[model samples]
Target: MLKEKLLVLVGPTAVGKTKLSLTLAERYDAEIISGDSMQVYRGMDIGTAKATTEERARVPHHMIDIHDPDYPFSVAEFQQRTEGLIRDINGRGKLPFIVGGTGLYIESVCYRFQFGQGGSDEAFRAEMQAYAEARGAEALHARLREVDPEMAEKLHPNDLRRVIRALEVHHLTGERLSEQLKGQKKQTPYELCIIGLTMDRALLYNRIEKRIDQMIEEGLVDEVRSLLNRGYGKDLVSMQGLGYKEIALFLEGRCTLDEAVELLKRNTRRFAKRQLSWFRHMQDIQWVDVTDMEKISDHLSEIHAIIAGKLTLDR
Candidate 1:
């Protein structure tokens, strides 16, 4: 029988999710379907923080390096791929683990939001995206609030894509995106246990800085340069990501190299803060504080018990 369970591992950036995910995969005999957006692109490794071959080989990982940097990717595509992966992995007598820090991607799977909604206002979406760039993400969200208060309440003012989408639904179909999600069939094919990992906010910030520094030392700039050399520019969806955007600014002489690095650090920290806010707002997720878990063994034991309890309940 297929083991229909989804073990979702989420946390803010730099909180060390990869190692824990690897350990959990081995422990649960699960296969991982990555929950990251940037990591899906090939030749974007160092900056995207894709796991080393050694790390990923030890635990089978899906959804990493699946696209070229020049290609476009979308949240809709992710949802479709996840639906297939869940079935394939379950058919193999293993559990499916969805792991990463991308809150929207996670929600796409967890809540199984319909990616095919027809209430798409192309003009409004274009306007909102431009507004976010010209004014700010908060300004776009303010526009959404005037149209869809319910969606505005849940989405962060800085979440550019969702804020635009919410406004688009209102302008196109004259219906709320929030209402669209309501009373709809959840597309999730698996029963799930959500795990949230965290550390002290200060400590998490330290780890993010250290990880970015390490990424640079490991040739992040060269990776971006290689992609650029191949003709991808800042306008590509892949290039719009955290690392690429800052590096592109530096290359464009909009900022000094040092300033670019500092901006990367600051922007990543803000992104992590946004990530934390998203995960924290989720009500049913069980959190494991990294500061409290002395060792992987201890952490694994607790997580194992949670999974075991789920199986027992099913029995």
Candidate 2:
């Protein structure tokens, strides 16, 4: 049996995860380690919904502002770093509270899904990109289906990045991606209590749109401008996220601010839908209905009670 408890807080964008996480952490006497993909960048704050400095000070948070926008960080790297930190936190007699809405990142820890051996090959990837361009996405996707049909089913047909990475793993390992992930999950070494935050779809979308508006009011455009002036472009993996991509399109005159904002809202809504799809498959997840609570304390108390009970059962 594992020696400690690792609690995960997961949900979609603009679900008030930050607010709830701070309160939960205080109640459980835990430190927050972010599972967000975009919030790691130092200057990309407004778009990523990174915690404000004052809010971060209220509850010690980790894994935000740890990189420059120009620096690439991957899910595999996040898995490695988060595992080490979780071990350290447990060693110190503290619960590892992994909080954020990035479903894949949280799943990485819970499932211990290995990205694969070695690392990304830029040259091989360029060749594959050319192949996808010359041939068709289906051509490569067919290849993935033969090896990792399960993953292909979960991914969309037009999702080029995931398709390429799935194909790349096969090229590198000569082992099927599905088999690789299956092997990893079978041998996962930890016991986790995963908590999911859920709310009504309409409310979630409204919050997403309002959050985007708030970001713009707080100078999201200037944040993007600074990153570009420092030499990052939309092509980089880190910069290709929803908010940054639309903002870059606006900055480069490809679209009007209004058009970009509309696209951001639509894409973010779609992203939330995808997140719900992803988390719905997660095993042993205890979901807390956020809107059910009348006040913040009620929500925190609900979450705290669940976690406390789970930890006791773990012991």
Q: Write down the lDDT of every candidate, Cα atoms only.
A: 0.79, 0.78
Clashes of 2: 0
Q: What is the lDDT of candidate 1?
A: 0.79
Residues 1-315, candidate 1, lDDT per residue (tens digit)? 543667789998889899889878887788898899888999988887888999887999999989888766778899899878888887777788988998778877887776667646677767777877898666877888888876676665544666767777677778888777664565555577888998888889888899999888988888778888889977666787888888888888889878988988998888888788778766558888886546777887877787776543332
Question: In model 2, what is the error at residue 69, expressed in angstroms?
Answer: 1.7
Residue 179 local lDDT, model 2: 62
Measured against the true structure, the TM-scores of the candidates, in listed sequence, are 0.86, 0.85
Spell out the clash pairs found in candidate 1.
Answer: none
* Candidate 1, superposed: residue stretches over 4 Å from native: 1-3, 123-163, 174-189, 312-315
Tell me the lDDT of model 2 at 243: 82
Candidate 2 residue 258 Cα shift, in angstroms, is: 0.5
